[model samples]
Target chain A: MKLNLRVWRQQNTDAEGAMATYEVDGISPDMSFLEMLDTLNEDLILRGEEPVAFDHDCREGICGACSLVINGDAHGPERTTTCQLHMRSFRDGDTIDVEPWRASAFPVVKDLVVDRSAFDRIIQAGGYISAPTGSAPEAHATPVPKPDADSAFEHAECIGCGACVAACPNGSAMLFTSAKVNHLNVLPQGAPERETRVLDMVAAMDDEGFGGCTLTGECATACPKGIPLPSIAAMNREWLRATRKARR
Target chain B: MTLGPSVGLMALATRTERRTEPQPSMTRIFWRSTVGKKTVMALSGLIMLGYLVAHVMGNLKIFFGPGEFNAYGHWLRTMGAPVLHHSWALWIVRVGLLAAVIGHAVSAYQLSRRDIKARPTAYVHKRPRASYATRTMRWGGIILALFIVWHILDLTTGTVHVGGFEEGRPYQNVVDTFSTWYGNVIYIVAMLAVGLHVRHGFWSAAQTLGAGNARRDRALKAMANGLALVLTAGFVSVPVAVMTGVVS
Candidate 1:
């Protein structure tokens, strides 16, 4: 298969960027999206051109590093992460426009590489088990309900890819923040820091220059992990309840 | 420091150009940018909702006595446009309210357009048997707008021509309007519109603000639905009581 690619190119954080077009021929249909990019980069290097700078580590979609906005949809119009996307999704002579996440909160660090450190900051704000980690307690000692455990695990699936942040009109990472907050906050071990977690995480999210949630469900739609929008609401309710409780 | 004729002419031209071109005010700023519009809508909508809650609470004072209720209205009018009994405070609030309504409507319009373009057949797979409130979001919003306009004309502007209002008995006019079966029915229908609008609006706004979570989406939805029910019930009860001769 042969394809046309219009990929964003920026030398550094301060460099102005443009979509630089390239052609990739003789690509196998079964090749992964990253593999295809790798082949293209091999060609670029052979021609003495600087290889396109992009983020990819595991190439299995678990690392949350192979991030790209393909053809205007985050993760290339597929329901999975970029690394999980395959060449079969495209056709011969297909033209794909690839760019990094375009958001003030997620600034481009280089070509197809964005600084998603804001998410890390937000997670650090409250997305943790504050209880001492040295204890050797049995896993079933707290006796978590099956439903709660299942729900926690579902929210725990979030990889903090910043896809929700990018897709949101408000540039809000609320879904991402909420998933992390709720994941731990719902558990017995997470109770001690629940109130503080809600407050600090919310404040951190605001400080990261992310917009407030409008509840359009766009984040959920764009999410490669299928993170639900409801998690944010739970965070909000928890925050409201915590504030009131604290006031009392 | 020699002021040549061309310099004077150039200065005059620059001054004229500056004067003719209106400076970009906050309203202009809001209208010119999407972020500005979102901010305006969020702030204004919250204010308007607060006002609505306050207004409902105050109007319920009619259950106390005609004098007490009328005094409350008189006090409100006194605060807005002052010495001539017109309170500037009221004008500020009125302007704020107008801004909220206009901003909400305008932003909603743009969002609705984008939504359409984003998913040309979004509701194609939507079940036809979905709740009336869920399916009628657009219709409910329109109906609520019409209801608001009618309410302003009937009570505030005195243009609806209810009998006792023109005779200097605004409280009695309200009672009379609610006492009639048809008027009571219209009021109930309008409240239903408010209920439907709020049902979707609350969560939708939250999403727009980026407050969603996968875990809490359903819970927030249930809570929003409950809020809508309570609000509708509160507003509907007043007219229902009057029609049933419970208030008269």
Candidate 2:
């Protein structure tokens, strides 16, 4: 398949960026979106031109390292990560526009790459359990109810890909932070620090300058891991409970 | 290689060091946190929603004839007759509604500015995202605000009334306001905006307040739709009746 691409190009973090057009021919339907970019880069290299830059690792899609807003939708027209999106999803001669994630918290590093370290800082705030580090505990040592375990596992699927921020009109990180909070806060092992975990992580998220949630559901729609939108509501419940408890 | 004695001593010293600082007040923390701000938005929005429900019900009383409607309007002023002074209850309600409006607007404005700032750049390819109600929230809110100002001037203050406005006779004032073509146009347009706003706002508030979940999602959505429909239809019926000479 042949395709026309309008890819965002930035020289560096401080440089101005714009969409640069290119035409690629002889693309196969089986090629992943990243592979298609590879083909474009190979052609650019052969032509002695600077290639488009983007973030991608573990193309298998679990790493959450790949970030791209393809044709105005994060991860393109498909409901999956950019690396997992196939060329067959597009028709021949289609003009595709690619751009980096746009959020002040996730600044563009270069071209289609944005710094997502804000997510890391939020995680560091309190997205973990307070378990002792001496040795691994037996799996059955703490009995987790089936429902709680299921809920925890469901929230644990968040890959921190930042698509929620990219897709949110407000550029809010509520969905991402909520996923991390719920993943651990539901488990028996995470009970000791439940209140502080939510309180501190939410504070960290705000300090990072991300926007507030408007419940547009754009974040859930853009999420590759299928983190449900209700997870945010659950987090809100936890935060409110913690705040009331702290006050008392 | 082994660590030097000085390095080991330095690590121990740093580990033992603790920084002491006063914790921020809970109010300061709540206002600063995005989640807290959203909680405020939810509460304020619900307050306004409650007011709308009451306002629509009061408005529908016009169909019972001018005598009944005018009596209801007079009762509004003398609502707390024996205990509270005349118009005191009305003033209290006005003050409460004003507070809710201010809280809702302030948070929305601040959050919107942050949201816009967070996503400094726009995507090269623009496709519509989210539902129509979701997308129209900001603009719809602005429309409702302007309508409120106009509504107060036309009816309450008599400043913008089309015809001679009386102080207590709300039935005639309502008829006079709806008598004008521009009045009908503005009222209908704003009512539509109200519908769209409430359709998304109600459900969004539920999520923000953590009152929503998978089990209650369907019921919450239905309630939002029901409220939007009832309020819009009830409010718009006044003008429609006046236009058709059914109420006048």
Classified by CAPRI criteria, candidate 2 counts as medium
Compared with the real two-chain complex, what DockQ does model 1 have?
A: 0.08
Best by DockQ: 2
Question: At residue B91, what lDDT does model 2 achieve?
Answer: 98
Q: What TM-score goes with each of the models?
A: 0.61, 0.95
What DockQ, between 0 and 1, does each candidate earn?
Answer: 0.08, 0.72
Model 2, position A119: C-alpha lDDT score: 98
Q: Please, what are the lDDT tens digits per residue for candidate 2 over residues B14-117?
A: 66333366678778878888888888888999999999999999999999998999999999999988899999999999999999999999989988888788
Candidate 1 chain A weakest ten by summed lDDT = A239-248
What are the per-candidate TM-scores when only chain A is compared? 0.96, 0.98
Model 2 misplacement above 4 A: B1-19
